[model samples]
Target: MNKHDFKMGFILLLTLCIMPARAADINAGKSKAAVCAGCHGSAGVSNNPMWPTLAGQSSAYLEKQLKNFKAGLRENSTMSAIAKDLSDADMQNLAAYFASLPGKSAGGDAAFAAKGKEKAAMCMGCHGQELKGNGQFPKLAGQHPDYLAKQLHDFKSGERKSGQMNAISKTLSDDDIKALAEYLGAL
Candidate 1:
């Protein structure tokens, strides 16, 4: 899109920010989330450090991302394939299932956590307490290590280009991003 279209798109999308915390359907979500379990983990917590932990994430963010994946705006072969088959209700169900679960730490990996703490201080401005996130910011605490690292890289390199995230990530070093991702996943 051109600059004008980009601006209009962002404004329209932002205006439609759907953080319906109350609109989630946990029962339906449980069923839809089963499919998500393959990548996001059984309880929205992925064991794979490369995948992001989805537990405790904002339903709005999850829903939006699923939409983006399906629309091919956010390019990911795995997520796109998964999202392509989902309906709006299915997205809501999956979002509810993941959001309802309690977030778990990466567990038993403390050495890197300290470094992660320092890096995360910058992140807290948007991600909120415990990285549960607020508004448009996504939950980062207990997120997948690999997902976080990839996103950070994406933000810095312009593959991902949200105004705030891109700005925040630009200030980080590669090591800083790695440390933060590791720490956030363990939360």
Candidate 2:
């Protein structure tokens, strides 16, 4: 084949390969996330403190978490069950839908902020300086204290497995987790 023709074919193939990453439909995501609204809230804020808010979370982080849940890399019974049935497109769309929504700032007790700040210093490495994480790590600021504590507890107990978080949580006391959660929640 001619060089120009070969280049054109290669470009077409590359575009098709990358299409799935760009095919997320926000409207479809909204529709699909209806089921998710039961726990994660209609607008991505959870009514229950035990459930984590999905709104304003990075799309990449959300997508990674959902994919991990489906793959059994992250262990949560409810999330695993829910994620198992989701197609890649569904997960992508859901991430987009939730990320598009406004996030909530559930304030925590002021008393814990000092201790939490000290404890959170270690978290700044991966979760960002302000805890408003990038695409890989999740945003911790403005999250629910209960949910954050639960996740930290789970990480410590080996229930939820993340290499860095597991090791970090292992050294934290109950008070540390509580303080960190409270501080982050208020941020």
Best by lDDT: 2
TM-score of 1: 0.79
**Pairing residues by index, what is the TM-score of model 2?**
0.88
Give me the overall lDDT of model 1. 0.82
Give candidate 2 misplaced runs (Cα > 4 Å): 1-21
The segments of candidate 1 whose C-alpha lies over 4 angstroms from its true place after superposition are 1-22
lDDT tens digits by residue: candidate 2, 27-82: 99999998888999989999899999999998899999999999999888999999
lDDT of candidate 2 at residue 47, scale 0 to 100: 85
- State every prediction's TM-score relative to the real structure: 0.79, 0.88
lDDT of 1 by residue, 9-46 (tens): 99888877854444768998897777778877888878
Residue 11 lDDT in model 2? 100
Cα lDDT, all candidates: 0.82, 0.91
Task: Return the lDDT, model 1, position 165.
Answer: 82
